[model samples]
Target: MLIQILLILGFVLVFAITWRRFGQNVITFREASLWSFLWLSGVAFTLYPGLTERLASFFGVGRGVDLILYLAVAIQFFLIFKLFILNEQSERKITNLVEREALSHLNEDEPASANRPSNYESNG
Candidate 1:
């Protein structure tokens, strides 16, 4: 009972924090909603562990704990994949910006005529 209370309190605290971040504009409404749902689900599961057990059995899992573990791992992998894609996109944007800036500076340093092909006849 004490553990349940503690877990519920922890989930509520996180839920509050998540909303606070949303209020502060640190996170978008969609992000806050997702986090809120996750925290609330945590609280719900903690309050009624039998729900997890039933779900576990329904899914053919041996135990509720195992189901939770499997779900946590799956979510972690999904988040990691998202971060990886975001990182790759950021890298590409940075590279393109750097290339554009370098080219612009190079153009600024040289005369415009230097960038154009000369009309001189080809030497045999």
Candidate 2:
């Protein structure tokens, strides 16, 4: 249980920092909120195995614990998928930005000074 708390806290801290940094153009608030929910839910589910088992049985799962864990895994996977999508979006944006910059540099005239070696080159 303690371990779960620490892990959850760690994830939340990292998420907060990442969300703040990438939140600008990376993910919408709604998406982030859902992402957070999925992660936190998994953490909560993992920590309370007994409760999860009971809930699972209540829902017709033969083994409540196993069912709960499986559900948690599924939920976690979904969140990870969403996170990956956001990550891909950011990566593509970066790729596009870099490509645009490179193209612009290619299209524009080079600075006149860059075309020739400096006077120091002759001295060497």
- Measured with C-alpha atoms, the lDDT of residue 16 in candidate 2 is 84
What tens digits encode model 1's per-residue C-alpha lDDT throughout 1-124?
9999999999999999999999999999999999999999899999999999999999999999999999999999999999999999999999888876775565347775676533434232
TM-score per model over all chains: 0.82, 0.45
lDDT of 1 at 86: 100
State candidate 1's TM-score.
0.82
Model 1 whole-model lDDT (C-alpha atoms): 0.89
TM-score of 2: 0.45
Worst 10 residues of 1 by lDDT: 115-124
- lDDT of model 1, residue 120: 35
RMSD of 1: 6.7
lDDT, residue 7, model 2: 74
| Model 1 misplacement above 4 A | 108-124
Local distance difference test scores for all models: 0.89, 0.72
**What clash pairs does model 2 have?**
53-64
